[model samples]
Target: MKIKNSLVILLVMAFGVFLFQVYKQHQTQGSLNKTAAYYNTNTPDEVGASNVVTAIVVTYRGLDTLGEVTVLFLTAMIVGYILRHGGKEKPMKNNTSEILITAANVLIPGSIILGVYVFINGHLTPGGGFQGGAIIGTAITLMILADPLGSVKKAVLHITESLSGFTYILIGLAGLLFAGGFLDNRILPLGNLGNLLSAGAIPLIYSLIGLKVGTELSSIIASINETGNKTA
Candidate 1:
């Protein structure tokens, strides 16, 4: 009875905290802080990206983005290593529904194409590398769900992930060397705004990010699926 009362009190306190946070956010709504105001005022002239959020993420705070990707890579590596050595392989049961299989076949290609389009035009649109890469990863996940025993080419994923990460770093280094600072998009011509080729190196940088994120996510999903198969 004492433990139950304590639990109830804890829950009420947590709920009170949540309400306080919500009220605080409401109090501060619709206000652009100094950082936001600065980004909004100067991002167009400086970064040339129509998507202000992407400009901030991929350029102004690019080192943070690099660290995020690095963390994701390490997570994938750890998950793969642990799962790969967890147990011996066993044949996966083929219990997937035909509807799911058919849907995966039909949607995977379109999904991949959309992912590519999203990352390539990230500077001009609302979507960016992370969103696009997640879409690609979802498609691969769907494929895995459809066929439990299907083989994913880990070698290709590894290669693509490595190359993209390497190229991403090189692009950042190029910006540091030739332009304003690290990951500065001004290394290449900014070109005409709103055009496909505009935004200098942002599109290229986002493309590399998309590829790296996609491959890393796919590799992680494949590892999980393989381990599930072995355990099943």
Candidate 2:
């Protein structure tokens, strides 16, 4: 019986490896289509948001962005729950000086602006919603690390994250219900590509993603630091 079980496990593992190989091949095939001229670059105007990738994320393949945000949210929730459960966090060191905090305060908004720029230009250039959102998340982490005492409110963070998630899904559903596909650009006016308002719902979705990433990352950082000072 034991040998039979071992053999079954080996077969399962081999099958899993085979599936992984197939997945890799499919991914390569998909990449080959990226440079194709039919790859949605025929926008009416230039993508308005700074990032070209953002356009691709929210406009062309928005479903993937939705899934990515869901993953981030689930990760944050799981990490917070795990860390909160008898898992004491070590107190964060107060190594950041006042000068550094002040500089962070000045730069946080700037970083956010730059992230928005990336999302806006996603179609015309390179960056997009996912990249810009990640940038914003990193910036928010810097703020939290620099000013642990002056952290953002948890209630606000929850609301921000929830709203962003809701807005993104609702927009997608609207497209599915009325428009063509899952992320069809119906509600948002598809302005000329390369222009500021181009790509319709793409900017809205990317901004939501950015907001959620920023708040979610900040919350994760706070979670670690929140209970670390427990009388140790």
lDDT of each: 0.91, 0.72
- Mark the 10 consecutive residues where model 1 has the least summed lDDT: 84-93
Model 1: per-residue Cα lDDT over 152-176, one tens digit each: 7889999999999999999999999
lDDT of 2 by residue, 4-85 (tens): 9999999999999999998888743434365544444553443344444455567677777788888989988987897776
Give the poorly placed runs of model 1, Cα more than 4 Å off. 1-5, 11-15, 18-26, 29-31
Best by TM-score: 1
Top-lDDT candidate index? 1
How far residue 1's Cα lies from its native spot in candidate 1, in Å, is 7.1
What does the lDDT read for residue 132 in candidate 2? Answer: 76
Q: Assess every candidate by TM-score.
A: 0.92, 0.71
The root-mean-square deviation over C-alpha atoms between each candidate and the true structure, in angstroms, is 2.1, 5.9
